[model samples]
Target: MTAAQARTGDKNCRVVQWATGNIGLRSLRAIIEHPKLSLAGLYVYSDAKAGCDAGELCGLPPVGVRATRSIDDILALKADCVLYMPQTIDVDDLCSLLESGSNVVTTRTEFHHPARLDRAVRERIEAACRRGGTSLHSTGSSPGFITEAMPLVLLSLQRRLDVLRIHEYADCSSRDSPEMIFNIMGFGQAPNPQAEAGRAWYLREEFGPSLRVIAEAVGLSFDSVESSGQVALARKRTTIAAGVVEAGTVAAMRTTVSGMRNGKPLMSFTANWFVSYDIDADWKLRGDGWQVEVEGDCPLDMHLHFTVPEARKAATTPGYTAHRAINAVRYVCAAAPGIRTSVELPQIVTDLSAQA
Candidate 1:
């Protein structure tokens, strides 16, 4: 049987957890507790995490699966699917996984829309799937949930569609990740050319393809994708949970990735992420959640909010991202070989029977 045919059923899917980061760590815990899935192997990037047990890394009892740092070790291991959630995209590692007879369900946001991907990269990934007869899928909360899942439903009621836009909001005033805020996100740093360049690159490379997925699902063609953003600076120095936002530093950022059809945006995804409401710019603060709107025959507006308390945000928020990808394992494994966009698969159903 082909590897796709050999992928086990929901009752006993063998899964490998890759990179125990925020979302990946929660997924590892879920895999250990999930009745339908088994933790076959674990992959970690740090030497400190390499020898630790998978369950322990996730704050659970040992599951007897030790984490490894070698790609060859993971390739030789037998697994029906790999949860490829690293901080960045590594097409080489991903291709090797698919070509090694293991399917992939990732949060990397690289394969959400195959047609939008660079010609050579998309072809390389598809070729790997063909050789191994395995399937690969990409999913996560923002680009996956607010980008594809929610909009897909909102647009269903519309017949003569004009435009669809999705917005992601985050109130990061109470976030406690200092490294993430000050260093990685450049929250308290003065605006520089490098920061603008980085945001533009992310928009074109990562979130750009996701916008195209929305258009593809709705049968709209994109002439091009327009990417842009502007930074909101702090008016005065203020201390929040993450760190102190110095006056005139970057306090917030808004990024817009639009799928343009005939020089106009038919579909757009905007990210409104702010560390404080005391910024010099007049930006909306809707707490931490998402808002999706469609202007069409039906004309509907809706917002999905995160209800997690401030104390539990770090622990609970990742579940929103991890669970959807985890729940997609069965459908992805059952899919035909190649990049499985959300539109091509069935509605993902959560197998929560084990929770009882």
Candidate 2:
């Protein structure tokens, strides 16, 4: 191996799988089957999944790795990188992993733009990076690929730019994670105007940094990145992958974050997520995918969609986010210490030889 490759990881990079949720489970399988990676350990939460073999969890033969619930156990492993895909992020756990000298690539949207992050949290992460000389990065499909990566590619073709708008549509009816769909996403719940408003504000905070990242890239200063949200109730009872959405309950939600320059939107991202189209609101629901439009000197429009039949969507959708995190393992591991935004890292080059 070359010096740089050795410093990061050899061809067989050792990775620790952080969780086994929908996305994490897909990541787990990808890592195990990856020709360039080897599974070092697995971390899971519930007692039922704790002692189970990794291969059993994903329907492969036993690979001899067992899942554990303890973070300390994970820290003790000799892993070059940790594919951290938990639903909620724990800052202390993140810091500990960095301090353990393992580079981290997470799907959480928190570290997309470190400068826009809360001052105290940013400082702590930086300190951990300095001490351990390890890097941390946050990436996923929406706030990641459609947010930063694709925009950069499109902007390079333009001399003068006007506005870029990204619309993400997800038919989440096939998602099997009940907690994610029901509690975290607030689907199947009666709307409280106040609670919905709070959720909107939370969405703003989550996506605002991404807008700042784009603003920084384009050399435009924004007054602020603003956000708003709207919700639609179910017109009748609808059965989804997770459970039931009764009439008058939240079935669809749309949240938007816009980068405002001089009190006007310069760049915007809108996410449309729905369990079913039979809703009280006449939302123009598209298939599960993304749409990007650049209205500028050189206008560009594109659509990215999933062609998987609905029967396979539940098993296949996680890969959309998980694969990116898996593909970024090498880039983040070799990066300089501190928060590595998608813009800072090298282009992700994948190894698909295993497919042959």
Candidate 3:
């Protein structure tokens, strides 16, 4: 543990839930229910959510924590940490929070690897951390913790290490975001190599740095990183919770990013996200949940599966993403001031008891 973590001791960590979106709502609930944490403030971007009780926004009884649309109010609150969960990352706003001496735990993809951030932005974050003496940590579902952090933990038992592979097969039919499903994911678009290449570039830049973190943690030097993607066309026109899926349009996508050493792949991350089960029935929903495969002297393969009610299926992804960060608040608060990753933090375990 770093000096920051040691200084935190056993006090109840006060937290502000910033933004109450899908993941934010889950985070609000988690912070309220966590044994070692307290929900001190709530931040909301939507006018509709403002002035509402945090618990009510999360479908629970009022907890006396009212949501506010004002960032200034959040900044003024006496809190130890903020669970930043905005849809789009606003670096300036984040830096402001850090500068106010509040440690941060976010599910933002861009912050997963601070080194991957633009030079200017990276330096700004570091400066803020130094000025405020606070830390920033990021984690999420697939690209965040499942693929990178979890695999690294499992690899600790290995007597020898050669290659690491992580896979995620998600059925996103129940997701609530229509724009994300249809527009951003190209769910109803024709296969275009140029567009696919653009997506591959995104995957590479988004996840490549994370793979580098893993490589460095395991003492491997990677020579190159490559990204590729394939799309599965819809078998037939279908309608799901998100939107319509036209036949011949993209129904499923498989994106892979690999880190290579000495001409062989050292680490690979693959995500198979789909809106329906018809696109590639054989491969769709194949894994129990997330899978990590390692090839070494003590070869190992592991799967993580969760059973949730059908009504809550759409929330599983965001819920896990929120918990990954929420559960890390204790460690992040105690770590040295600066951007930190799951690889640097201690193992995060969930504690649901009322007493710390």
Q: TM-score for candidate 2, please give it.
A: 0.90
Q: Give the number of the best model, judged by lDDT.
A: 2
Candidate with more favorable, higher lDDT: 2 or 3: 2
Give lDDT tens digits, candidate 2, residues 1-356: 23345324446779999989889999999999998899999999889999899989988999999999989889999599999988798889999999889999999988998987789999998999889899999988878888888998998888877888999898888887799899988899988677677877887887788878877987887898788888999999999889988889999998888989887888899989999898888778899898999988899999998899988887888898999999888888788999999878877766776878
lDDT of 1: 0.86
Model 3, range 1-356, lDDT digits (tens) per residue? 64344334578899999988778888898888876788999999888889999999998889999999888998898589999988888888899999998999988778776776899999999999999899998787767777677878778888687898988777777776789888878887888888789988988887888888877887876899999988888889989788789998888888888999889888898888887778744664563378889999889888877677668676665677888888788888888999998788877765655554
State the C-alpha lDDT per candidate.
0.86, 0.87, 0.83
Pairs of residues at least 3 apart in sequence or in different chains that clash in candidate 3 = 4-334, 5-334
Model 1 clash pairs are: none
Rate residue 249 of model 1 by lDDT. Answer: 93
RMSD of 2: 2.9
When sorted by lDDT, best at the front, the candidate numbers are 2, 1, 3
Clashing pairs in 2: none
- Residue 343 alpha-carbon offset, candidate 3, angstroms: 2.1
Measured by TM-score, the strongest candidate is: 1
